[model samples]
Target chain A: MNKHPHIRIDRYALVRNTVFVWLTAVVVAGFLVNIPRINILEHTARNLYFHVPMWFTMMAAVGVSGYHSLRLLQTGSLIRDIRAMQAARVGAWFGVLGLLTGIIWSKFTWYVGTDVWWNFDPRQTMASLQLLIYGAYFVLRSALDDPDRRARIAAVYNLFAATTTPFLLYVIPRQLQSLHPGAEGNPAFSDITEPVMRLIFYPAIIGFIGLFWVLYTQRVRTAWIKYRVIRDPEL
Target chain B: MEQEVQSIQDSLRAKESISTPFDSIWTGADVPTVDPSALEQVMLSNDKLYVVLAVVLLIWFGFIFFVYRTDRRLSQVERTLEDRIYERDDEV
Candidate 1:
């Protein structure tokens, strides 16, 4: 009835359209723009534009989710709780996509002529572990029935989950031996990655993160509407 | 199709002759090597470009699925709103 004071639908529409066009351009450039092919990587080096962005988007989602969870703790606002929950849900989906795409990329590129689909590469394993941590966050939310109690407890758990994400996705993976580019003793993006690839890669990251914002915000809006009508925000 | 497959195989063989930094990492003594299966053969073709295609498609599908789920939530909220309106009309 109050026109949903917190959300500006017009602004959301503008962002949604921008993300749609931006990502379409990214996908086109991602394939059309050529780079110097390497021995194992070859054209699959283009995966830097697609596969890597999933992780970056997931990281951004985690940051958004964590910030909202922190606010939920401080403000005791149900809207913040809804936002934090939706962010984590969407973020986890991105992580799952990242993991699956990584598996596919490695299957053809790294594990070619081999029977391996999953060899437990350090980064791959740690990424899956990070997803499981977010998985626990969802399960924890479902366990609590009272909205306020659920919000408080889930926010605390989400913060803990967010804290582990950096370590699991970046720190631990870099510390261990990994086929992933940024591992210890490996030539990272700065050294081996081509400038042409970076041209598409960075934009791909921004576009995917923007896309995440669109999806997450849409879910939050729907959940907020449910809260206004039914007094429950879980969707 | 056969010629295309042959060209891909020739290119793959040619690539094996030249050593790069990745070769050292991927072909380490500890690494196990085996024959590629049919699925691997298809994916490994065209400089493994199909792998990039697969990755992109997977992400696209993932987003589509998420969108569908959000639409479902919207429908549920709309139904609830409709029910509430009907209840108020009855009260009136």
Candidate 2:
């Protein structure tokens, strides 16, 4: 119904908006660079540096949703279910963006043949699995008719699927062969991050996180409004 | 991530224990570590990327703010109209 009729446009968030703007500029100008005049970024062109953080933020959101889903099961509250579903929905969007950007970036830099469609890298496989797990959440949501049962079963599955995120996406791959280098010890970050990479990478993480929060609030507001609108037609 | 790492480590401990992370860092790759002389140059190059990144963030956020503001305003107008309808009904 999309009835979020009372968002005040949080001033703090607006002020916070400046951070992302600054971050994008810093990463673009400072990090998309090379010296010795050689383009170390090469065909990757700054995409690789920032994209990782966005993907992680999205993953975190889904993980939170899973956590909340279990909480909902314990409390037997629809509110928790709503929150979980919405978080997953938002995470799905971020996941899509990350995967697409990664693919396009790889095509330009990593792929060398007509077979630029997919790679067997740990990063790619894990990412694909993450996507699939979320896809199943949507399937689970729709497959059942009883609202209570749907929430319960979906919540349980959410925990199960989300618990594997760290293993499938981070741990196992880091343990196994990896195409994305430096992931063995620190997939989240590289300690040798040049001050330049940090300039971009740090803000990229901030900006993406801000975007996630803004979307999250929007979802929450919309959901609350939807309930109000549906429950009270007079209002 | 930490939990997963611990889980992996627990298994490793059950197996033969590695002396330290240094042994693992020297895993398959044999890339030469940088010398002290090149430290200054590496730092400068990395800083350049930061400048580029800052610019991109500004533009990205500016666009987002514009969209958010527009949406907020539209919602405000919708809410006001809804209020006016109720007020008119009362007056009648």
Candidate 3:
């Protein structure tokens, strides 16, 4: 058995260590500091700082999957294939986050007639559909019995699905009318976005990113172990 | 003869050059150019924020569930490895 020469334990612990202190200090500091809470913020309280970052990190992971898919096709590496799979899985979770957050925010804003699970608004409709399309990439990979063929096909599918992200996230929202306004104009919440908002938002993003890394590593490790089990039954 | 063979190999390599149409993802018909501001509202009320928070939380919980479920299966593989090693030692 040829082991990888240099082994790194995913460095997930560093993320945990750094983020715990960073998130705690930011929360405490935000509470102690005299920051003007905007009227909209006063309604949601302080959840924006926490949830929006999760969506951003998820987008980033999906984007990574696209990149890895390209690399895998070019080089035919299992490492890239595994990373791509982990990223897609993690990205899907974030897709759910973005959808839920948007739906909930809509309810609070409208305060009437939003029982329908989905609306045809560009952001809501396109985002969910985009996720659903990418969701099939994993199904395609898993359904195949041959590893080499599976990776190759999944890479192609991933590349195709990834092209939709830019459209769904930035292009479609802009082309058609959307309920979500911050995407196009005054992205930093209405009024003067306090330095305090940045203070919370930045670490929250880093924390979510760290959390994504930890999950991505765990998924990859699990996949590799499963491969090992099937490959070497006795060992 | 060597020069002729070398020329033949060069032609074969040239024939293998990988090129295809549709390399550019941003081609005709798919291009979307419009001002994003022409879209609708972004401001949400306090109640809406809570709903959004709930949805985001649910997603996070889902991530936790899937990750742990997959990770737990790794223990089974490790156990199988240990049993195999034990069986081999007993035979020795």
Expressed as tens digits, the lDDT of each residue in A1-235 for candidate 3 is 2221111443554664565456556544434345565655553445556567767887788888899999999999877888888898998897788788877776766444547545677778888888888778867877998888888899999988988787787677876656565555535255556666677777777777777777777677666666666776756
Off by over 4 Å in 1: A232-235, B1-92
DockQ of 3: 0.11
**What does candidate 1 score on TM?**
0.76
Off by over 4 Å in 2: A1-12, A19-40, A43-45, A113-115, A183-192, A233-235, B1-66, B77-92
lDDT for each residue of candidate 2 in A37-73, tens digit (9 for 90 to 100):
3243453545655678768778778777987898999
Instruction: For each candidate in the order shown, give its overall lDDT on alpha carbons.
Output: 0.83, 0.67, 0.66
- The digit string of per-residue lDDT tens for model 3 on B1-92 reads 44644544454345444344532222233322331121111212222343454465566557656655664575466566667767887997
- With a 3 Å backbone cut-off (N, CA, C), the pairs that clash in candidate 3 are A43-B46, A44-B46, A104-B52, A108-B48
Clashing pairs in 1: none
Model 2, global lDDT: 0.67
Cα lDDT of model 1 by residue, A1-235, tens digit? 4445667767877887788778877886887677886899977788898899999999999999999999999999999999999999999999999999999999998899999999999999989999989998999999999999999999999999999999999999999888889998887888988888888899999999998998898888888776776663322
Query: How well does each candidate superpose onto the true structure, as a TM-score?
Result: 0.76, 0.66, 0.67
Model 2, residue A157: distance off in Å is: 1.6
For residue A93, give model 2's deviation from the true position in Å: 1.6
